[model samples]
Target chain A: MKVKLAKNYGFCFGVRRAIKLAESKPNGITLGPLIHNAKEIERLKENFNVVVNENIQEIPKDSEVIIRTHGIPKQDLELLKQKTKNITDATCPFVTKPQEICEKMSAEGYQIIIFGDEKHPEVKGVMSYCKNTPLVIEDLMALKNSKIQEKVALISQTTKNIESFLQIVDFLVRNCAECRVFNTICNATFDNQESARNLAKEVDIMIIVGGKNSSNTKQLYNISKEYCKDCYLIEDYLELRKSWFDGKKLCGVSAGASTPNWIIDKVVQDIEKL
Target chain B: MKVKLAKNYGFCFGVRRAIKLAESKPNGITLGPLIHNAKEIERLKENFNVVVNENIQEIPKDSEVIIRTHGIPKQDLELLKQKTKNITDATCPFVTKPQEICEKMSAEGYQIIIFGDEKHPEVKGVMSYCKNTPLVIEDLMALKNSKIQEKVALISQTTKNIESFLQIVDFLVRNCAECRVFNTICNATFDNQESARNLAKEVDIMIIVGGKNSSNTKQLYNISKEYCKDCYLIEDYLELRKSWFDGKKLCGVSAGASTPNWIIDKVVQDIEKL
Candidate 1:
């Protein structure tokens, strides 16, 4: 089988910066998983002695802490500050834009509507910035049941689909007296999805390499599955089956923002050998 | 023949208020046509001696001037103020909202996008309030060929259709970094269009009663024609032909914001006789 790779894939600017910041300081602890990739986190644990701690209270006093790229809630950050003065913030600039907008708009008396999964870490972080309780909707159906105020501001998760976000915006503008929209989806997500979609259209089988819990990876898998039927999402090369590649003439490979180049290279090499 | 009227039709609050204000001051020269309906303007001229003057410079010094409901340009308003202190501003509150938003958003360093006809008096009035030159687009195709800025504020004419205005909002929110949308479309336009559409769907023939130059009337006619094939737009009962009601058992009637109730009553009476 002829193997082809997407033009844009692997670690994005925010993920790379976070990884670099983590490596610079040894024996440090991250508030959460530094990035979505499990293999890279394991590598950092083994080489730099950086550990992931889910609970903020579990960390020892005066320990060096690094924030995750998705960011923590506003109150959590304040608590972390009281615990220790040494803190490294790895939150993405794109994600911070919505947080600031929410704080400002909410203070200006505009109701905030966040278009994303309420359980998602990024959405939880953004919601904490609002002065009033913000309405978080996953889709258009959720909005249909809710009563929106006269003035509302809308923001979306950084890794969400643009088409879906616009549908929510269209609904709000038609019903409300005033609507303010902030396009907070990052450029990396756009480029990665576009490249994966283009490559998937011309291939017989597609392989998406990323962590199972990664949001952008799932988005890529979903988009690729629409174009190519024989598609699989895996964390590493070991999950690939030789029989699946037997009848395929052309194979396409794509990865998410948190996916490291080494993992993608391993997957490509294993597919070639099959 | 059975004559049916729309549940919501005829003079809106703004038009009624303008007419009442004009009638209170007899012998006042209106800066422009007080409203879209020619018949109503003629009635005002004959009954109250209110004259329509299109040219601003031709008005004699210290003359009583009544502004049109759609409003004049910002510079024209300034000149009118200088020309005479005795002025009655009849500009609709719905139309004034966009003008205020344009001035505020423009001063805050945001580009303005007005979703309406460039030649329209309302749009022209709104554009003059913006500090920078604003872009006016009638449809989505016009926006496709133009380049939008990073930050944009969108406002629409009060009489525009809700669906078309929402489409422009969707497109701008998807492309721009920041978008502020003010839904300036009035409630009267929504009620009128909805009522006309509901009646047109069940009637055998539809009659849209309003002036040819009225924007809201044209919108009602377009929406009615979508559901009923035999639909006619007429200024008065005299324009209604007997052949239109030849085999039609039910006739639906709808009027624009500027249309007076007396004209609608005459049309209904004439339809019954046919």
Candidate 2:
């Protein structure tokens, strides 16, 4: 099977910036995984002595702590400020924009409507910025069931689908008296998804290379599955199966924003060997 | 042929309020046609001596002026205030909401986007409220071509199709950093259009009753034509034709927000006679 890479893939601006920031500060403790990719996290641990510590209470006082790209909650960040003097924030600017918008709009008395997964850390962080309680909805059903105020401010997760975000906007504008929407979806995510979708249409079998827990990677996988039924999502070359590529004439590869270039190259090399 | 009336049609809240206000103040000169329906305007003039004056400069000093339902330009209103103390604002609260939103949002440094015909009086009125130059787009192509700012405030004409308005909102949300959308489309307009759409599907022939210049009536006619090809837009019973009822098993009747019930009833009665 001949392998082709998606036009746009691998480390996005935010992930690349976060990695560089984390690499510069050796012996730093990240509040959470620096990025979603486990292999990259492991590499950081070995090469730069950067370790992931999920619990804020576990970190030693005055230790160098790097905030995750997803960012910590407002209260949690304040708590960390009190705990540590040496801190480096790695929160992506795309994520930070929503946080600021939520805070400002909420302060202005506009009810905030966050269109994202409630359990996602990024969403939790954005939610904390709202002075008033925000209605966090994952789907149209959740939005429909919730009671919305006349004046509303809508924000989306950076990795969410643009089509889904528009649907929420449409519903809110139709129902609410006033709706303020912040297009917080990262441009890199849109490019990756578009590339994956275009490549998936022409390929017989598709390989989505990224961390299993990565939101953008999962979205790519879901989008690719719509066009090509024979699709697989794997983290690294070791996870690739020869049986899956046996009869495939062409294979397409795509990676999430968090995915590193080296891992994608390795995956492609292994696929070629098959 | 069976003639059926749409569930919701004619004399929207704003029109009803304006008519009552105009009738109460007999011999009052309306700054412009109080409503879009010419027949209703004529009825007001004959019954209550409410005359329509298109030019603001022509009004005599200190004359009683009733503002049109569509509202007038900010400068025009200001000029009227300076000229006379006997000004009655008949501008619908729905229309007034967008004006206030545009003014407030513009004063706060957000670029305003008015989604309607540039030549429309309501749109002109809304545009005047913007402190900065507002982009008035009637279609998606215009919106795409325009150079938008980072922050935008969108308001639609009261009588525009909700679907078209939603499309503009969707595009603005995707492109702009911060988009404030005020759903200024009147509830009566929505109900009338929806009713017309529903009735159009079940009828062989659709009769849209309102003035030729009425925006909402044109929208109803356009929507009805999509489902029922045999659709006609007429001002009064005199405009109805017997040939239109030929071989039609079911006839649907709908009217614009500005259309009075009496006009709609006359059209339905004429259709029954045919």
Candidate 3:
């Protein structure tokens, strides 16, 4: 069995902690599929004996709960805390920073604005840190209509594009009288985009690594797709068809945050065999 | 009459509409500076202006309300409408469209991600359109952290930087599993930026026209400043110093969306006089 692992392959700090917490759980429900990888999620399901991230339709008093790597909205977390007897937190620390910044800004009487999807688990988790409802405006037109009194504060989710954040900040500078902004995009994401972009420039074919549902993995593919003509996003070695690699010379690989070292290694080895 | 008229004088579409509506109001309470230009604002105040953007404490219930050219937040508009018996809305139509798109997306369950600022009037206006609490994550880190579960929709403010917007969207396209984005940065804005960039290359001195407070005007300066050795943002003829024209054989003049034709003409006249 030949195999090569992605440089970024394996459980990231957050994912590893989440999986570890699940294993240590005496008894609890696993919030939403813990990670995107089906195999990993399946393994966790088998161990913790819990369901995916679903609303509590039925709950027994004092039932333990385990939060996933992607955190929950403030309301959901609060509601969960209120209803549950014990909660095991597994959200990433990097993910929590934006929320903290936003909350601090809101406390100081600044109109808090967040940049990202309003409904994303990460956005919700970040927003949860805020004291009040954040004004989530997604485009310049909405920005043209944003009603900040005197001062405004801005923040973003970690996985967001850096260029987008600067654009938004520039827009704010152009539109508003007074504004404050925080650049909280993660360093890892920057490395991924920069590396992917550089790799895309040199490679003929860019094979992105990660599950289909993984957002970060999709991002790597998208960045690579812009520069390279042939870029395919795949989950694992099993998904790679023999013919897809036909006549391919140089290939670049990238993965999502949740991917493990073993799977990345396996996919690379399989591709090497091809 | 020291009323030195600029060749590029009078209100641009946004300011014109805002001024006309405010003038139509024989009554009270101006929502914002009718225009960023102090002279124009002074004239409005002398006639029928009562400013209330970041400064006003309380507005009477029955006062006539006028919105400015830069656009106001949706919530503020709503509150004003409720407070005033007669309302005179004068927002520029060009600046209004992006807000509509953002609001619609927010209502539809898409993540409202703006490519612009959190405090900009345009962004604030757009923020108001969000059905739920929206976010304004700026930069790759913010977007990376955003990882919202639902779809993300992005739009740019009319006068934003094209390169910046695309970079952000590029990040968005990669990271987001599914996204719908609109290049809402206005046509005039693109033309202005393109024109300025192109002119910056050939001109010895690039004189940017519009108010210091004007966002687009500043962007024009930034763009021109890049290619040209001498690029100055001039508010009017009065701001033109003799030193700017000291031995300059050729000069280029460009105006912002809010800059009047008379201002550009005055600047040109000043350059000629030098």
Best lDDT among the predictions, by candidate number: 1
Two-chain DockQ for each candidate model: 0.81, 0.93, 0.03
Please name the candidate that would achieve the greatest DockQ relative to the true structure. 2
lDDT (tens digit, per residue) of candidate 1 on B28-139: 9998899999999999999999999999989999998999999889999999888999999999989999999999999999999998988888888999999999999989
- Candidate 1: list runs displaced more than 4 Å: A2-4, A198-205, A226-231, A241-251, A272-274, B1-3, B242-250
DockQ of candidate 1 is 0.81
Model 3, range A184-229, lDDT digits (tens) per residue?
6665666777777787887767777776776667777877789988
Residue pairs whose backbone atoms clash in candidate 1: none
**TM-score of predicted chain A against the true chain A, for each candidate:** 0.97, 0.98, 0.86
lDDT of 1 at B274: 81
CA lDDT of each prediction against the hidden true structure = 0.92, 0.91, 0.69
How well does each candidate superpose onto the true structure, as a TM-score?
0.93, 0.98, 0.54
Please name the candidate that would achieve the greatest TM-score relative to the true structure.
2
How far residue A267's Cα lies from its native spot in candidate 3, in Å, is 1.7
| TM-score (second chain) of model 1 | 0.98
lDDT by residue (A147-182, candidate 1, tens digit) is 899999999889887878888888888798889999
